[model samples]
Target: MAFTLLSRSPRLVICALLCIFLFSEVGVPRRASALGINYGQVGNNLPSPPHVVQLLTSLRIGKVRIYDVNPQVLSAFAGTGIELIVTVPDDLVPGMAASASQALQWVTAGVRPYFPATRVTGIAVGNEVFTGDDEQLKASLVPAMRNLHAALAQLGMDTYVRVSTANSLAVLATSYPPSQGVFTQDAAPYMAQLLRFLADTSTPFWINAYPYFAYKDDPTKVSLDYALSNPYHVGAVDPYTHLQYTSMLYAQVDAVTFAAARLGYGNVPVHVSETGWPSKGDANEAGATVENARQYNRNLLMRQVSGEGTPLRPKLRLEVYLFALFNEDMKPGPTSERNYGLYQPDMSMVYNVGLNQLSTTSAASLSLATSPATRTDVRKDFGSLCLVTSLAILLITQALLL
Candidate 1:
């Protein structure tokens, strides 16, 4: 009823429309049919999950992965058809491994309530544990995965959803020429066990492969064109397999594929859990620029659209979740760490990678009452941006009426 009256008041209506525009986005579909994007919320400013879903739907982007099982996000995505891959924070790994009940409890609380509607396709056990210095954490990885899988099986959600953990490319000790790829001595035994679990579970081996790191560390040696997936660069020859690699991203992925094959689990699918270039960086952090970011993402999108696969596994179309959806301002480390988003917190594109714009759509209002706070991720965000704007519009309309 208020919407009716507000629509009749030109000035008040203008304010409402402007505020909504400030909080929402509708995008044109990139040619990519199955591109996945990572949604990180480490900033004090980000659109709420509902707004984000509307934005992604407009762009026709389908898959998404979040660092944690945020209840707000899980609830908002209900019936949205967005396949979400939620993570179990690293700190919870030991508890999950120590007790099967703990894992079950996690699933009961984090997953069960929203699953069928949320389309939670997978649960990432813990990210990059092998690359960390914690030996206990590395040892606990498999048990945690097993217990979680058992919990899923117990609940009959096993077949409905997959179980796996994302790993750092650093887990590889040797990754040159593709064929020489091997897991580090420290990570080898664990990787062996992990790969076996994946093979059994029929899940994927998730790797966060970033060729930008290799180039940033040694730009002169790593061709800029190759690193950015530019098609014109003379492809490098992986002498052992002789599979030519025109893109460093593909080479890194193939390296992981080879590493897994060496471990006798070649049938296990290798997916890129996280990969993207930063739009800005500090002076010491080389190769982090807006232009580079645009090129990297644009090229990657083209590959996804064309259904291109790595030379090692040419038929299996790569399923990649780009590193981030927004530039998280509060993330620690170098400036580059905070600048990986395709859009700013307010949802403005950092640089267009051919993601066109279309007509507007309504984003459902967010209900923060159910969004529980977590000790692990205590950072604040502007998820309330739309709500605040809506209130402003209401107040404006009320004043005009008075």
Candidate 2:
């Protein structure tokens, strides 16, 4: 006979769930721990670094990737227990490659001071360098990553903090069919060698895949449902693998897997370093609307919760860093460039994924606001409000006199 545990009361189940929310490690349930956020700060009016840290910690988000190592942010995250992935700006690549000691010094200065307290977990060396015009930078990318890894190894931080670099989809010349994926001819050799390095080091291959770009660039061809993860057409079938793909994002991911397989490093894991749809956009930038944004992220998060894998790796859950945490005002390009955030500068949700205020109330006791002694930024919120009010009064008096 099949056996089952004696049933618990409804009240007990609710209480058990509450305990899991407030006290579980990362407080996101064991299954959701793998999801991550990309914390880009190319804007002037974002919440103070401390508040940003608070917001992530309060929401129980465990993994986050910042585009650059801003010390203020690093300092703010100290003791917050959020696993941060820090980045090295492109200009530093040549220097990091020229000397291993320099790499060590850079890490010592940028990463060492905030250790167990800050929960820094990874270092991304020079993002998208392979796709840039700087030939010198492209050449230095792998060596720089290797030296940085070596430096971390020397400091005994390599085990916990891995070294990696993020790549843009531009690296691939043809990615539509998935199975026939191939890297750009000029980038092929370097990518092959880089794949070998990642395979040997057991590090993930980080790719910044954006299905929105595909849909926008060829609106006549790409399906909106395929891009937004709605019930849609069977998108494309990989000729070689014979796997049918239903969405552009999954097809994009499988393309990377196929490309790596072509290089004989098929076992190396691929992670999405950035992917999100904008809530607003210019007229010609089709598919960048709040509805699409909500659908895309909501469906993506649901798939993540299900622990589903790409067709290439059926059992392994795909790790993703959602494109951004805040809408960056200073980012160049079309209007869509600044609108990928899931939250606005004021820390309000752009699109709710069932994290309503009521559901998160029990979690409020575990919020960062409770730990005033641990972070001064939470306290600064009051100070900033006072300052803004004072300025507003001054402006009103001047207007009355005029």
Candidate 3:
């Protein structure tokens, strides 16, 4: 009897495997690249980080970038398997550069405990330090980065977590031709040395480029379609590189590429640290309408999934992180600056950009809120609710079967 049962079990397992394969093949959309979202919480009313994890998982976004090493965010991401890139805020640079001990202490307290569970893949030493007003901060940028890298190396986490900084396009001198790009005279030496360090370490050079700003600055001169990634019209070409570019954003990227090439670090990889359009803007902030924001982000996401690269680097897949997950009302900027979020503070998408849905009306949207669960909060309210509902339905079906 035991041998006969074993003979039938193999057939049963085969049938189950076939069913699982067929179901999955028919169900999932064939997205090409891994999707990553930025989870910035500059607002006070955002949801808890754990709940944000639930929302991101439901949306199938596998990676996230946070603006700071908030212990709460780091702790919440533990065991979640979401790859995170955390920041070392600009203000921390002075202190970190002053003391290797401080850098070590900060890393030990802020990063060490969450290892293996949190999957912190990258550390941004500072955001747009080159663009900041303080000359000391600018000088401190690379040193702070070096100190942090040393600290990570001491902890044996250097290979797993890369160290780098994000630069604003203000670092560039001429971005118009996209091929004739160069750093401001004062910044050239510092930037070149930083680029060398980045290249040596195999860390990606991060830049924040926004064509929206270009268009807003000179709408009459900038083609709307060109800025929005609309291929309605034939675009310009770089005479030097002979690269035919379609969008201002790509041109901006290639300009940086050429600039790095000029500085002899052409091989260094560049990543878009931030880019997005705002749904609302001050009246003078041209091209900041809701429709334009939707189109810009939708098209950007489409391009990202298509695995498209700039004309200069045709084979490399572009790694991009959209800016501001929530429209942080408190952020000091033109109205548009505060409104670039993909979602609102209340956990709803500012607009849909082709997320999957079983029912036509369902929203598989992104949210910026953190999770409410404490470290000890084991019973996830959302997960438990879903489980209880499933169990109740199962009990009902079993009673009917009886």
Candidate No. with top lDDT? 1
Predictions ranked by lDDT, top down? Answer: 1, 2, 3
Superposed model 3: Cα runs more than 4 Å off:
1-33, 357-402
TM-score attained by model 1: 0.80
Q: For candidate 1, which ten residues in a row score worst on lDDT?
A: 362-371
TM-scores of the models, in the given order? 0.80, 0.80, 0.79
Number of the top candidate by TM-score? 1
lDDT of 1 by residue, 1-402 (tens): 223433456345334433432332112111123678899999888898899998887776668899899999999889877788999999999999999999999999999999888988889988899999898999998999999999999998886678899999999887786656678878889999999898676577999989899889998788888999997778699754556889988888877766675454554568899999998989978899999999999888778766687877665457788978999999999999999999898999999887553112112211111111321121122234335545655755664575
Better of 1 and 3 by TM-score: 1
User: Which 10 consecutive positions of candidate 3 have the poorest summed lDDT?
Assistant: 367-376
lDDT of each: 0.77, 0.73, 0.72
| Weakest 10 consecutive residues of candidate 2 by summed lDDT | 1-10
Write down the lDDT that model 3 would get.
0.72
Q: Summarize candidate 3's per-residue lDDT along 1-402 as a digit string, tens digits.
A: 112322444334223322322232232222233556678887788889988887777766656899888889988888776778998888899999889998899899888888858989789888888877889988888888888899999999886778898899998887867766677776677888799788667677989988899899999998888898765558788765556878778888877865664565555668888888889999899999888888887777767656577776655556777776678877887899789987888889888776444113222222221222221132223244334434433433343343
- Model 2 clash pairs are 79-117
Colliding pairs, model 1: none
